[model samples]
Target chain A: MENKMGYNASFAEEVFRNVDSGDEIKMCMNCGVCAASCPLREHMDYPPRQIFSLIRAGKREEVLGSQSIMLCTSCYTCVVKCPRSIPVMDVMHGLAHYALKKGYTPRIEAARFGKEFWNQVYRRGRVDERDLAQRAYFAGGFWEGVKKILEFADVGIKLVLHRRMKLIPEKKIKGISTLRKMLDKAEMLDKGRSVQ
Target chain B: MADVQTTNQSILVVGGGMSGITSALEAAEAGYDVVLVEKNPYLGGRVAQLYQYFPKLCPPNCGLEINFRRMRQNSKIRFFTMAEVANISGSEGNYNVTIKLSPRYVNDKCTCCGKCSDACEAEIDNTFNFGMDKIKAAYLPHEFAFPMRYVIDPSIVETEDGKKCQEVCEYGAIELDMAESTFDLNVGAVVWAAGWNPYEAEKIDYYGFGEYPNVITNVMMERMASPNGPTQGKILRPSDGKEVKNIAFIQCAGSRDENHLPYCSGICCLASMKQATYVRERHPDCDISIFFIDIRALDRLEDFYTKVQEDEKIQFIKSKIANISEDEATGNLLLEGENTRTGEQLRMTFDMAVLATGMVPNKIDIAGAPEVAADEYGFVINDPEKAGIYGAGCVRRPTDVASSVADATSSAFKAIQSIARR
Candidate 1:
């Protein structure tokens, strides 16, 4: 396949600069151990190693559009086994957050999951599993919801057993406005708009 | 005769693994008398288990042969196999040590023939073989095993059957009547090179290491890839003995987590990649996927990673596997993980799964000597103030063979310097 290239020098600089953990990204040996160790690597459009390579090569559009970065579990196995101890998981998560800010359409499942989680946190100030599940099923669109409902019984039994099967939403806790403010900040960040 | 008196002193090298061998050789070559004690019946340590060393094609025998030869010729370097330093006392310039040597039953006179193995009725897991295969009660450790001698595992050898092997042997090499003995020696310094054990995978239940047949550790993969191994270097699934088509290597199975060992066991990444290359070479059609948080191929090793990636058969994935289950009938490994980029949780199947387990320091109970300080990760801390002891190889920290050797040499130099100054 021919390599598609795009450059985002400023964004790349921003990512490198904003990483909380002090690690040198340039030292990556690209052994693909991270990708290999990643539990979700098989489903990603581009593995962790390729994402780094693309980011380094200035392929911002390809990276943003790629479905791989959004699937990170943040399990930190790669961070731990990293011979150079690169903050790879965090970097990928940060990049995924960056992509979300742009107008890029998130893969259906993750986008709906994210929206449901946000709504739960926004409306109830905490996650109400039943509400979140219903919202998630509806927001993800029809066929997806039907497909999920087919498997929901198995999932619902476990959730019920764990006392997570709540029908009545809890009274809105004290943190809704604070959560809304955080969401607004996140939305702004997601849009590539500067956040003070 | 000279104004500056250089005292002739003996140094005790504990655990004849890589670091111990290096320390003993360096100190002995420096004209100091050395006593190397190994709990196992042979030297060469973990390196002997490996088929090949990375970056260099040198087999374990290539380096070990020279060291073994040096030990043979050097009278000053008195060594003991199946020996443990039971008690150690005194300070750096002068120290007393009591060593307990276990009975070998078969002595120096025994020729390494297949007779004893055939005669012996007892069978046990060969620790040297990484327990993938079995060995007779009377067996040699490995092909190019140091000392080039066979040992009897007294624990497994039945008293009645043991006599049968002794009677069958034409050569009077079998000495079932031998007894364990202890000896006291004076030494100037001590080098603790106990090495490391692979972090136990039992704790990481999510990986299904013990629960699933196809889920094996990286060390197991090493044995599987070795020509002298159980499968004779064939990468096949343990569940069905079918040739592995899709292999998934999970990096950092137990290391680099606050709940387990927090430090990276330096070589797991390179080891996994090397195994991937091994599989790619052996079975061109095999689909190899490595799931990891990052690709940590430092220095020129990055080139090797790139080369491996260029192979279409190998795929790299960036995600940490949170769960692994087995498909009961097929024994195919079901792995669940989140693809960070797409924010999607994914499920995949593999014929076999290899967990890149990290290293834990070898468990040794040293008595009478000052306690050796180790980090939370169980790696030895080398503070000269603490009993004047030094640690080398994996004991000091998790390192590759090159780094381990370098660390051993530096540790030897430091040990020699300490003795010389005194």
Candidate 2:
């Protein structure tokens, strides 16, 4: 009851100015279509609409620390259903990407899986399912990783038996050195994009 | 010899719906000759299709009958059904207009006896009921059709059944050899009452309108509630003949959105509210839920909205429906939205769903239609400088029935002024 009514305009401004596709949230009319359509809404600290509201309210910690922003699977259900044509999926993903760069760790496993998947993509030219699975499974440290692998052992065996994934420590594609150079150049260009 | 004569004094009213009919009557009653042209088999048009009107919730027959009586009493007004304005030449006080008439097959000799419909075997969709029911190949347009004529479907004209019906009729009303004819008239001014059509529901893919049999549009809901409707005013689910107790009315179905019509259709909020009465009248205990972004029960209609609000069974949820899915196992609809007030995420399943689809104006895109302008939302803009042309009713802008009538009379005055300019 004693709390002062205040909003963090700087945080909102930062989001609009720096976060990719963050400006799209300005179109949100608080219709709550995204929250209702979201299957993972019950598990979130705040729904997509609430996340947008929090950002506007200048509740910087609540917004940046929200698991809802990080939990977007990019299903595009919210994207198509938005009456204002707000790219809700892109905004959520952008917020998640921005949060990661700001040194905020996601509280949800889905976000970690995404980070591992992206890391594997960054290191290799293409994904080796085995390598990607190893990183994703081992993300929670040795004990949890072993439990996860054991849980998915049947599916892994089926994939292996079907030759869908090979046991080999997947060989690099041709011209790996050139690919690395191009990736590094892209990263450098991307990093310098916001500085100006 | 020094005096001048104005030869073209007649006003032409296009579209035979409420506005067009009112416009013709108003101008004609003002001592000017009027010609009314419609593209349907009957003159009543869309007003005749409605089960009831808003505010008072009076059946269209009450008003249309009075208009029909006025048309009958006034010899100054000449009306033609199944006709279109094929061409327009000249301007303002002196104009040459061409009218093309589609043959009704059943001539003026028709007594509206039950003989033709009984003798005929072929069935067709009864458009008056919005295709909710079927009519015979030879049938009356509606119970209150002006000119009181029966139209033989062009399909049955060459068949044996047509000849049989012709033979069975003692009045000799059926004319199998009638052909489409075109004629010209000199009119000083024209009133465009080209009305609106329901926004196409299929385009809102998430609603699953065509995909789900139980999901119906607001207009279809109107048809269903009519005594002459598909299930004879039972409010039954279209998938099965079971009565619907849990119904959801989704407002702003295709209006007020960037992806669809950008303008608020001006009447859907009230129309859906009126439709709630349609459900509540039959099933008093029915739990009718209306989901809307805002309750825009404007002006005097707000009284009726309050009356409906008093019903505990009829609850209002503040949310625009984004998607609707059918549960295949139950054959019921799963609607997802939110109660913004309660901040509660809504995942509701209903017996049937009514999508309150908004109005889309009928475009005056024909080759010879006058150069009347339309605003961004395709609503006709009546340019005052454009001499003889005027857009009335929903064609000018989306409006309710009461306003459409008032609009018709107002445009009639403009048309009269245009004709009297000489």
Candidate 3:
């Protein structure tokens, strides 16, 4: 075992100096509030509390590669109820973004669904069910999309009959620039390029 | 004639922490006679523990210094440090309070000389340092501590050294012999701003705070990261004294759990994110991760979370740690849990861990204090219409410093209304 005596004075000083308002990371008292309240705790490799420790200890790559972050639905259940108000969902999303950008393949099916959703939203002004379904199927893989194509035929026919399906894609919204700007800003902030 | 009426016109403010101090200052400044009672030896509360505050660059000393000056200048605000309200009688604007004050071996006459500290032969865990460092029996709470005085801990003071401390002190500030005293006062209104204690880690054995040397709490992290703290503001593993390469922040350690505090303590999530940023800023090469169930950023706080996410050095995981154990040889932390989204179980290791403990109300139960009501969680129940009896800061609900100050100001306005009605 390591001699639990010395501390890093320079590192601590630097933390004190550079730690901004959002950087109010604290020490874990080992209370299991995060794990107990986590809606996705049952599915995570390392629960919220452990994830925090990993971050504090500077294990960023391991946490980014972990599948635990991809499972978070961003429900804000833990955040609303956290006694410490640690922004669990925000942290999870931040890690997911990092992992995705770093080329860490998400092991969760839900993540693929989210990627499809994002792509749909980015490419098209509005989400169309047929387009979304097609995109989701394709993104999931060719075999999975092909296998689901038969199941989707029934719904596709109904949508066409009801005129709910758009054949040529809707007109681009006028506020796309603003939306792009906001998304870009969010991405930049999530990447920690600029402070709010 | 009418029933004999006792004019208990004094207002008693309990728990001389930041909220309590604000409440006392606000009420006293309104020209009401106030009696402020503190459980600790000093007046400044958790805010004093912080190295620096958010939204503003002001240190705890900067804001607290102003409050201290106001407290000293306002004679109407009578305060007792190391005191607690033993019992209470009467109701709304007519409370008879008995305050039991613990002894402070040093009196007001002594200057802040190091004689008592030097002469004393006692060492104990410094609560001010969050137990990271030892302190002499005779010591100042912290740098720029209010009253600028040194205190001798009777619990640790040796009999022979206690005498020597008195002899060495030129100003005669050391009082080896002191007694706990009880005093009674009548008050017209009472503001119970008794703040919160970080949820104890022992309750949740999964995180292994007491069992693991590297596993600490958010409060301990605050002290560890504070410039005035034990390490002089260094982030290192407690077990090996090695520079931390990987750190993890576990949020909602004792909060938002049905088995513990079901309600959100309100600040843990932001606090962890802020701490992550702290680590990243200090050790650019260091890797940081935050595990949380959700990111509960209400309104503008979402922006803050977004900003933290942008730091490439920091990572966030959306899992609640189900188990934690220390590696016997390396002192590294081993954590295990399932990835809900992927339906896969995983494990990882880290140099140190932090549990984001929640807050619990100080007043678990109080008799004869019917004028004040508490929620199911024991937080002081706030009535927007009620006058005089005001709840501010964490006592009312979990909030950040800015929100707590706003609550104090609002409570002050309500108190003003009550006095104006008189």
* Number of the top-ranking candidate, with DockQ as the measure: 2
For candidate 2, lDDT tens digit of each residue in B85-119?
Answer: 88887878878878888888888889998698899
Local accuracy of candidate 1 as per-residue lDDT tens digits, B198-233: 999988877888889999999888788888888998
What does the lDDT come to for candidate 3? 0.74
A-chain TM-score of every model: 0.73, 0.83, 0.65
Q: If ranked by DockQ, best first, what sequence of candidates would result? A: 2, 1, 3
Which regions of candidate 2 deviate over 4 angstroms? A1-11, A108-119, A128-167, A192-196, B1-7, B327-330
Residue B10 deviation, candidate 2, in Å? 2.4
What 10-residue stretch in candidate 3 chain A is worst by lDDT?
A1-10
Lowest-sum lDDT 10-residue window in model 3 chain B: B1-10
Top candidate when judged by TM-score against the true structure: 2
Error of 3 at B218 (Å): 0.4
lDDT of 3 by residue, A25-100 (tens): 4634434455555667777878766666555555655566788878788787666645455676766776676567
Residues B38-112 of candidate 3 have per-residue lDDT tens digits of: 887787889888766763435678888988999989978777778888888765556677778787888888788
Off by over 4 Å in 3: A1-196, B1-7, B156-158, B384-388, B416-422
